[model samples]
Target: MAANTDETTDAELVAEIARQVPDASADEAAAIAVAIGAHLTDRQRAAAAAAAAAGSEETWDGKEWSFSGRIDATQKRHVRVRQESPTDPWSAAGRTDRM
Candidate 1:
């Protein structure tokens, strides 16, 4: 029997196994494929949940920091916030001759 972690598709693996064991019934092969797929799906879901719970924060150039927010399907494309100072380089460019 092939190792479970070989990364072969369930259908490919089932066909290979059936070729090797001609006595195995189609129902048995199908059952094995369904079981393996379910196990892999459950493991993937658990891993994703754990990763989301361990949220990470990052800073750029040791000066600016950014945070990630979860957006649902109904949320707007952009969220607006007021800043004390303008952050647009184009707007600030006309005010100063530097650069």
Candidate 2:
């Protein structure tokens, strides 16, 4: 929880960041939110694209992706991960070590 940015004052921005990346650090979430606020900047676009492409077969609830897959490595950053990267029958778009 470290938001040293002036944008933190905006409750909407903070909430949106939390909604998108709940586990993200305040600073990381803020940076992501700010970039996303700007009509989806390069980083934001890449992240969204990765999310969309990863769980193309899953259902999205506007936030996290829901898919039927075996447990695999979790990730902190949003990036493209190939389906065959893991030998598992299916791999989740993303997972977390914490609940």
Highest TM-score, which number? 1
TM-score, candidate 1, is 0.40
Q: What digit string (tens of lDDT, one per residue) describes model 1 on residues 1-99?
A: 323545545678788767876888876775566667768778998999888876643222322111001111224233222232233434432422221
Model 1 ranges off by over 4 Å: 1-10, 20-23, 56-99
TM-score per model over all chains: 0.40, 0.27
Pairs that collide in candidate 1 are none
Which consecutive 10 residues in model 2 have the weakest lDDT in total? 63-72
State candidate 2's TM-score: 0.27
